[model samples]
Target chain A: MSRNLLLISTSTTHGTGYLEHAEEEIKSLLEGKKSILFIPYARPGGISHSDYTAKAREAFERWGISVSGVHEYDDPVKAVNEAEAVFIGGGNTFVLLRNLYANKLVEPLRHRVLKGMPYMGTSAGTNVAGRTIGTTNDMPIVHVKTFDALQLVPFNINPHFQDPDPNSTHMGETRDTRIAEFHHHNRQPVIGLREGSMLRVKGDGVKLLGPHTARVFLQGQKPMEFKTTEEIHFLMDAY
Target chain B: MSRNLLLISTSTTHGTGYLEHAEEEIKSLLEGKKSILFIPYARPGGISHSDYTAKAREAFERWGISVSGVHEYDDPVKAVNEAEAVFIGGGNTFVLLRNLYANKLVEPLRHRVLKGMPYMGTSAGTNVAGRTIGTTNDMPIVHVKTFDALQLVPFNINPHFQDPDPNSTHMGETRDTRIAEFHHHNRQPVIGLREGSMLRVKGDGVKLLGPHTARVFLQGQKPMEFKTTEEIHFLMDAY
Candidate 1:
């Protein structure tokens, strides 16, 4: 059994419907699977888990795939174990990880995904599929027992990675600067997945997908840009 | 003794020298105090503690005030207890809090500030002066023992808060939405301090200082905007 995943940077892009840009990839990833266990723990915009699950259901309904919110089940760990495919929506990473820990679903979900169950995540969801949630852009609205994640991927994923606009006057730290700061303390490689960018992993192979180029940050090195057509599979061996 | 503090949203604005915008406020806050203790734990841009303290020293040299980096002292806890004035510089909030806890300075630093020591903080420094660092915008490069902060003020502070840009195409969550999501799990009020803004705390009174208006977020109420001249002391009693 090996990893089968589609980790997206964002569910929706500017002026696009939810999951519209990744509809093709989503359909391809869930080709034979009829139902997906939707983990709505992220709860974007403070929406309830049920409401968030409904939004995911609507999105997957186009392909005639049934979706169930994990929280709806009496035993979330059992739900993850029995799930054919799992999808985690984007929201607050700290809150999402906290709930994952509280429900004791982290190990079950990780085992299922690592055992060849198809897994899809966007934004905060993708952040948790990495080695840790240390690279997340979301505010720490809540505290988890640890910054640890599922470790489905070797490196951390920084979703919605924005390029510094030379014309802007805002003085906030740029995405690159923040990632660099993370490197100062930790030695993990970080992938800055821009909007519309994602990574596809199947067994030992990994590839960058979508139109944009992704930025890679290594400890004590300048961040470099890599395109979707490049041989990015070597990133899997970096760790 | 009562709280005597200056909490600033940012150390420098665009096209301005470090601490230039708040020079007057800094001078007034440190009136008759010749020297101050500087906590350079934030370490923005991966700069060293000595370098960060040197920057603060140069900034205060204009006012003939001597500055000492707390890290240079043999006993950081004792330094915080005996310091006449304490300043925490802006950088990474998680790193700052981690160092504070590692060096056993949280209790002493908070005790001194709560006992009427003149304290000043900028950016990450200001975030810790609140109930918790849950509202910080900085990246979580390191994990602290706790998200608990000074609790000198009643509500959490979201420093360098930005309003949603109508013309921007970026799809990231706005500051207001993030703070609103925080309200879903926590009951504490959050003060969204925009750049160039500072809160002046004297005894039991807190006044909004600076030219721009500040945004306040309550658990069940809509966010409200208040100007510098407004009577915002009611925030001190919310907790």
Candidate 2:
């Protein structure tokens, strides 16, 4: 049975208000699924079990899809194993990585997804699906025991991309400068995702979502911008 | 006639308590100089001109050295040109870099220092002397206009290198893990300096200071640790 996965960059209850479209896309993904489970285990946002469960319930109810909050289950693997599809909400990338490692879910989650289980991740959750967890700029507000992450995607993803903050006083390299520095050493391409956007990967290819632009940075070259509708064929070729 | 240049990482009056030691170091470096002109152009910590001038005056008074604060000079090159040895107080590296670039002081400072003006740097000031400002862990709280550095030292220096925070919940990556990842891509060696420790480069050799340890990391190898008194002969070899 081939299952699908949806990863969202954020799970703000109102959806990405910019396009007023996250809910619609999510509903379309879950429309015909027989079993749906919400895994909020990557609760870096200090989200309690109940809070995450409630958010999942809210989103599911809006779409009229029966959803179960699986975090309450003693064995998350068992819960995930039975689910036809999974949706992960976002908060802090480090928090999510910590939770995933703490729950020993990296391998199991990777296994389920590889076996054709539908998986979805937003924000921090989407960060976990990348090759390395170094792209995140969120503060290490909490310490998780391990630094390993799921290597579903082969490149680093910088979400919530924006220009340099105008009011900051401590002088340091900007995000663009830091990314350029990263490129000086890393050959891997970094994908910068703006707000109200996503990269949908089916099998091995990724497609952009929403109206925002994405930037691809490679070593010794200028960062190239791409539209949301362009096919991310380069990622497959590079990796 | 040689002037004194006292480069400190933090402003002494900022309540960081390193002012006494920094004062002593400066006095030792400028033993025979009777009058010292203080230049506070790298003002990144939101330090007011009067406040910085007063701090320099206090340090000089304690050392029994005559002092003149030159904060009103407006032009860094002009201010630096007349100084015997300039003391650069550190707050943030990026802020310092920005001011240095805006004032066009890199060439003047470099030329003066190379001409046997005893140069001293603490913390962020020391970072500016490095080949590149890539190893700093300071928050990108502000953006500098450029990434250019003074390049007094050939390698990147990680200052205030304490062990990983025990209470931090961020399980993303340890400094070691991040450095390892950095090594995977970057071939340059990173010198980790613990608090109270300093790296002194004279001629072609580098020496460590204070009671802490320095760790040198290179690609494909275990990090090599060194004591404060040890000579970092490898740095000489690199140059």
Question: lDDT of each model, Cα atoms only?
Answer: 0.92, 0.63
Quote the lDDT for B181 in model 2: 48
Tens-place lDDT per residue, model 1, A130-180, is 999999999999888899998998889999999998987777898888998
lDDT of 1 by residue, B172-191 (tens): 79998999999998999999
Q: Point to the candidate with the largest TM-score.
A: 1
Model 1 chain B lowest lDDT segment of ten: B229-238
Residue lDDT tens for model 2, B93-146: 656675777778888887787665766676677777766665655433244544
Model 1 ranges with Cα > 4 A deviation: none
Looking at model 1, the pairs that clash are none
Model 2 over residues A1-239: C-alpha lDDT tens digits? Answer: 24354555554423234213576666666668755787666554355767877867765765666678777788987887778787766655555776777777778878888777767777677777776655665543344444446766677777666556565332344567666655533566778776667777777777888777888877678888889778886785566
True contacts kept of each: 0.72, 0.00
**iRMSD (Å), candidate 1:** 0.8
